[model samples]
Target: MDFARTATWATAIKNLNPDNDLSVPLSDFLRRGQHFAEFCAFSLRESSLCDFLGEACKCAAAACNAPMAKVLQLGKSANRLTVIAQWGMGHDVVGSDAGLAEEGNPPGQALVEGTPVVVPDLSEWPDARVPELLRRFDVTTSINLPLIGRSGPFGILEVDYPQAYQVGPVEISFLAAVASVAAEGIELMSQREALTVQRDLKEVLLREQQHRIRNNFQSIANLLSINAVKTKDDAARRGFQSVERRVFALASMYDHLLGLHEQRDEVDLSRYLGSLCDDLQQFYALKEQGISLHCNRRLGMTVDLNTCTTVGTVVNELVANAIEHAFPDGVGRIEVALTSNREGSVEICVGDNGRGTRVEQCNGTGLQTARQLVTHVGGTLTLQSDPGKGALWTISLPSKGHSAA
Candidate 1:
């Protein structure tokens, strides 16, 4: 019942050498290796294939009681196998390549035969092409396990010991099991990296598309401005100017969307509403009439992009309407306020200290457009007015459209 005490006994059983082990079940030892490999694979989800291999080699070398461990991956060229990760080697083997046809290479043989190759003694081996290299490193024993995944054999895991030790069936089986898990982990990691690259590329293309759309809108607005200035009739000129303001408003929407940088289905309304008010004040030429626009955003919130655009367009139309009709005497102030209540609903108030107009008499195209936008955003619009006093237009938007960032 006491797992901790049992684990302590397991830890105290220190002679991991299979040749000396006589008490613990061999399955227990192999189970520990399997658990260790699973832990490594599970914890390394975000790491690169090389990092995974490096850590794997370290663990494998310790378990096999080997002095060195190396993992080679198949390169783009079919016959080339490149050393990607290694542990405990006196010299670096990373980036070194081995040809498939190289004679007496156990790794190449394992890859070809789809099985493990064990050399219990390298010094006495007569068929080894690189026995001198092994002798130079003081390596006397080696085991190469083919890392075969669902796609087939993709690489080899080679471990080297300093002494000429007899290779046992238990060690071979354990190493083969490790190689199997390593192959699957490498395959999953590779797929994840590829998907990340694709997602990044998609974001870049979307940003470019937004930039192009904004530029196109700006060009159209410029053309409208040119035509408005050249027109002889006052009515035609005013109409052109109105169209130009709408175009610029649409362009500002794209500007904010692009500024977000990442793919987002929601928009920050406080920043968006403030920017919309600034743009409308300039577009309506209110400063020339000694009129000032003040914006008060008390709460920060985000809504879907569609709702943001609707809210922005409504604000643009309402503010423009006030500058043109409310302040007929040509000198006054417009205050824009955005606030949220305890119920999580937002209220946007646009008020002007100018001659007031009745809500029923507000039959202008801009007011009608604002009403439609408000309805689409699932909000209500209320107008308060007195003949000599200022007028205030309030839009109450529910919190349903908000996105929880």
Candidate 2:
């Protein structure tokens, strides 16, 4: 049988046993399903908007049988619809009208003074501005759709082809449908924005909050830095540096949160993890010493910004503990892995062959604080060691989705 057939058979085997056996395959397969569901449900909302726009563009392109087509979202506050996504286009034309809006600019003629204008031929346009733009970008024939939405004129969908192509009636209808979808998406966006706000408030009660969390993290780091400097001992200074790194990790999560709009609930965890790892490696030199990342490229899920940041900080702390305590002589290996189970729990493991968790050596306050923070987020940390083998720090992030209820 093929791979799909094989998978189907394997799934049948699992379904046959609802007893929840201790087999690794049974557990892993179930976990993978949960993660997959989360992935589909929690992906980019803007892409849904972007997809609608792109489909409209594709339809319009096919109707005209045009070689090149593009769609731009006219900024509500700005005068132009910026190029959001595109398909088959001219050489000089790439990024030429990227953000070109109507403000009495050269290409501004295409926007029809912020109004939608359609031209059969660019070189033979009645408007001087249209012909001038054609000359600037070289010979071109294009149709511009003033993407009208529920609010007002949103943007322009420009479909272009060489001199011979013609924009037909079928294309025009499809173009109109594309415009309608874009409008509908923008209208629902305001509604979704309200829903997102309510969702965030439910996650953490704070009014008038628009990413002030980032500032809070920075402030904490500042305080730690000052305290570290006040102590003269090398060990005391090292202690503060440790706290500072954890604080920065939280700051990075806030950065991800601030990047999202009303619709986006998740950020690229691989990108997020790689960046945090880079910062840690630079300071502690994990790259120079043998460190590898085994994180899933598609490993991402949605949680409240506060929760993610908290997780990030904990990861930073545990990773630091492994690096500092794992390889005492500054030589060893470390691996970071992020995987989620089907039951909605996330398994984040950071391991090093240098040494076991030196918790007994860690001071009481730091360890206690770390433990409390993990508990708050519904997670637990496990420190594993083998006599001569390295150390393993396994962190389990509880599925906030089911539990948040």
TM-score of each: 0.85, 0.42
lDDT by residue (1-405, candidate 2, tens digit) is 223223222321321222344333555445434533333333335556555555555555654556666676656666654566566653344344444465433234434553334565655654433433345445466666555444445566677766746544434444544444444554566567879899987656443353577678878889988989899999989889877876776666556555343225544444566666666676566667765434432344555555566666777777777766666676766677766778878666777776564546555565567777778878887777765677777777777622321
Model 1: per-residue Cα lDDT over 182-226, one tens digit each: 666766776678899999998788778877888799899999999
Q: Please give the lDDT score at residue 335 for candidate 1.
A: 90
Clashing pairs in 2: 31-341, 31-342, 74-81, 80-101, 326-354, 326-355, 353-390
Summed backbone clashes in each candidate are 0, 7
- For residue 241, give model 1's deviation from the true position in Å: 1.3
Most lDDT-accurate candidate: 1
What overall lDDT, based on C-alpha atoms, would model 1 receive against the true structure? 0.73
Give me the overall lDDT of model 2.
0.58
